[model samples]
Target chain A: MLQSIVHVCLAGLSQGMFIWLVASGLTLIFGVLGVLNFAHGSFYMLGAYFCFMVLRALGENFWWGLLLGPVCVAAVGYLVERFFLRRVYGLELPYQLLLTFAFVLLFDDLVKIFWGAASIGTPPAPGLADSIMILGRRFPSYNLFVIAVGPLLALGLWGLLEKTWAGRIIRASSSDREMASALGVKVPTLFTAVFVFGTWLGALGGGLAVPYLGLLTPGMGEQIIIEAFVVAVIGGLGSLKGAFLGALVIGLLSAFGTRFLPTFDMFLTFILMAGVLLWRPQGFFGEAR
Target chain B: MSKKGMNRRQFVKAGLMTAAAAALGPAVLKPTSLWAAESKVKGPIKLGYQTVLSGTLAGYGEFHKMGAIMAMEEINTAGGIAGNKLEIEFRDSTLKAPDAIQNARYFVDSWGADFLAGIDSSGQALALAPVMAELDRVLMVTHAATEKLTEEQVFKNGVKQIFRIVTPTYQDGNAAAFVAKDLPVKTWATINPKYEYGFTCWNMFKETLSALKKDVTFTAESWAPFGTTDFRSHINTIMDAKPEGLYSVEWAGELITMVKQGIQAGLFNQVKHVMFPVGAAMDVLEGLGAEMPDNIWISGRYYFLYPNDKSNNDWVERFHKRWQHYPAYVSEGAYSTMYAFKKAVEAAGSKETKAVVGALEGMTLDSPAGKRVFRKEDHQAMYDVPWGLTVSNPKYPFKIMGKQVMVPAKDCFARPPFEGPGTKPPFKA
Candidate 1:
């Protein structure tokens, strides 16, 4: 019984970590930019597909994919922010949303055209293909690698945002865009970089996920986007810290809900979202309006 | 203004006309029958086909199109059906029920399709039953495998316009049980799709397995929702229960994910006996390729290599040469359906709906999947599909079934009424 509980918890943790990889990027972009980039999930999907390309090129080394897949996605993010997203920065939220939503449809169709509508199998990470014994139960090592990396990346992001000068400029621009521009900061360039950084995070999650989930399909990002929004909203939109914890909470709830109360599995996430909305409207870390 | 515009009396007349339309039919409007009454049933015999054309299972649509078009080409080359030039129009039916229903109507009403074929989902097939009856167009269901489409929709409910070319859950559930009962396993667990097809198959397997074996118990079950990318939690649940055998009815892309993840989590290592009802599908086999674990049992509606007959083998070679890919069950079924139409229409000597249906009722046709007889009772094609263990064959790139077991259809398929345990060999669990 204890072992089963441990298994569920471990499974939930890995699931949460995967969601965090996607949610972290979404939180950073939505929190800082006040633009609900619906295409953030598309970025996550592109990460997986791009990672597959690299993995196909470089063999099944997990590190090669992690190193290069997000870089490609970051390039995409850079272009999107510079040409398209740049036009809608100060525009109304609906305009930004409409543009991102259009990209979602475009990207999904583009993937189908390029990759075809069939599912593709991804090889496991080179050495972590085997399951290790945990609590007298076998668990996937690829999952363990993800769980470990989720927090490490969170810490790395924290150090970058808190200690670095570039991070300070980003904070300044996001909090007070006019003040930063008046102080001679290249605000548009900073926004582009920040968007690129967030894109990288989402892509990184997708790259890691290719080996973990071991499959890719078109419209795969659509489902994750809904869950990530729930996590982001619950964690207090834009709060990186909030996304991390919220991902864990959502993941565990999904796992347990599917197991114990299978009927409520679909509604449980929304119920939590509704509860959060009724009580803490600003989210776990958002500033009160 | 008074001459052009409506007065109170004119407005009331228009309102009455609107209310008449509203008060007419309780459900579906019956204009399809009048449209069918006007159908010329002459010149070219047009067939409208639709399948999952743009999602994860979009490959299925490709396969369906390949087979149907191939068959259409062959027929047109051979002077067409009933001395008329056979014409076909393709539409994306999508996964939704309403879309499928609309497509079926469009095929008959607007597109002037004499015949309709290739439905992918059982939900869509069931939804189209009454609509097909209203349309009076003979629909040959190629992919959807829910038995209810045949038994309930066609037989019980008297929705006779529907006929299934593909073998339904009988092969997946009861025939699987008949094969599994001889094995030593006792405890079984299942993870299946969350919809009607999944539920019916699982129940059929459990019911038939229980009847066949005295001691077997269903230990655990996990239902995977549509578009489930992860099965780790379901895996955990099954492992916790520690069943002797795991039977998963997950098909296509989802099955590929489940198996790949199963290998990673060592689920296959712990559970010695694993059976995938539709694991032998072309998409699953091609996707998994060399990594598909050996000795795992798999079955589908039809396999390319089965029958081991000259016609079947010759058909397989031709299909590969044409499409550069082996035929999936849907492909074979779709191909067979086209031939069935030819035989029916030629035998009837008319493209009329009633005449073709009459000829098709108990018609036997020779095709790639061997001889298929559409059961007059429920319009289900009674055919053989084998269950076998996966093994790498030198002739093929992907894993092929080795040591195949062919269970006779009569031993597993339900009797005429198909009501319950009292009426059939395999019943609801």
Candidate 2:
């Protein structure tokens, strides 16, 4: 029983990490840009498909694909922001949303044309393919990697945001965009950078996720996007710390939900999200105005 | 001598033709041009296939579309059904109920389809089943396998115009149980997608397992929502329980993900036996490719390469040639439904919906899956449900079912009499 709990925790952590990657990106973009990039999940999907194609053409070293996949995705993200998202700045939220939605369809069809309408597999990393002994039972090492990386990345992100000059510029602009512009900051460059950075986070999540989930089919982005939104909402839309917390809670809930509540497993995540929203409208960390 | 002989032969032939024409007189003079002038080309019959075409279960919808196209082309080449040609118009359901219902309306109202068919998700079927009753048109269901369309949940008076080509969930679940019992597995873990059909499969599989092996124990049960990309936790739970066998009712996207993740995590190596519902999805098999281990006990709605018979081979070969991929169960379902509709239409000799419905209630149609007859009692189509051990074939890209066994639909299925006149039928599980 102890062993099972430990295994479940590992599973939860892996799932939590995936959610964190996307939610963090969503949070950062929403915080700094004040624009909800609805197409954030599409970037994640591109990373995954990119990894699949590269690994298929190359070999099954998920780590190599994981490392290299994000570069191209980041480049695409930069282009998408420069060309498409730049127009939507200072515009209504719905316009930004609609444009992103169109992007969702565009990327979805592009994947279909390139990959065809079939599921493709991604093998687990070579060394991490084997399960590790934990709490007197075996658990997958790939999952352990995910568990360790989530918090490490969180700390790294924190250091980047709090301790660096570039981070200070981002924090200043997000807090008061008009004030940052008055202070002679390169406001437009900051916004573009934030959007591109958010997109990079999404792609990084997707690339890291490939080896564990192991298949890239069309519309997979849409499915994960909903869950990421739930995490973002529960964690407070623009709070990176809240995104991490929300991901953790959502992950554990999803993992244990399937085990204990078997029948209601499908609704558990949404039910939890609803409960959280009812209790805390601004999420766990957001200030009640 | 050779040149002179050839010249003599040519002259003799010309002389003979002139003599024969002269002897035949006016009869031979009749215009050979009349027959050539009378030849006329007819237009193709357009069929609108509305289905879940681009989501997690998109493969099923696409398979059905391909099957319909294959059947239409094959039939058209053989002079078509009653001298009319066939074409198909497709719409994507996105695996949503409202989308499917909307597509149904569009197919009938806007597309003006001669025939309409499709559905991969049973939820979509339940959503659109009422449209069949409302519209005075025949909607041949090819892939949606939920029993509700044919049995208990079917709208009052809806059964008349609706015909099912795919075996319902319970029927397919029963076959999985039957095959599992033959193995050494005695304890089981149930992991199915968290949905109506998945729940239905769990209940039916458990019930069937109980009946087959009364002493068998169920150790754990897990349900993941449709399109669940991660199965690590579910696998951990099931593995912890240490069930002798595992029953996974996941299909298409979820099934492929689970198999790849579960195998990598070493669940297959630990479990004594494994059986996945819809284990025959080509997307799952093709996705897994060489990584899918051999000898996992699995069953699906259709296996294109199963039958050794000539007719089955011919159809399979033709379908493969046309589609460039193995026909998943959805394609088989669509192909079978179209043929059933064709037979019904011919028998009724009218495009009138009621007449076709009457003909279909007790119809038996020859399909690529062999002879399948709809049971008049429940409107559930009956045919051989093939279950097999998954084996990787060097000749093919994906794992194909080998050591196959066909359990005749009648042998495994019991179309219990409908709970008549207001008493609710027992909800499965």
TM-score of 1: 0.91
Superposed by TM-score, candidate 2 places the C-alpha of residue A248 at a distance from the truth, in angstroms, of: 1.6
- Scored against the true structure, residue B136 in model 2 reaches a CA lDDT of 44
Q: Which stretches of candidate 2 lie over 4 Å from their true place?
A: A263-268, A287-289, B1-44, B153-158, B416-429
- The CAPRI quality class of candidate 1 comes to medium
Docking class of 2: acceptable
The weakest ten consecutive residues by lDDT in model 2 chain B span B420-429
Which candidate gets the maximum DockQ versus the true structure? 1
Q: Tens digit of lDDT per residue, candidate 1, span B87-169? A: 88999887899889777766775677889999999889889998888777899999998888888899988887788998899
Task: State each model's TM-score restricted to chain B.
Answer: 0.90, 0.84
RMSD of each: 5.4, 14.4
Candidate 1 wrong stretches, greater than 4 Å? A60-62, A90-92, B1-41, B420-422, B426-429
What TM-score would every model get versus the actual structure? 0.91, 0.89
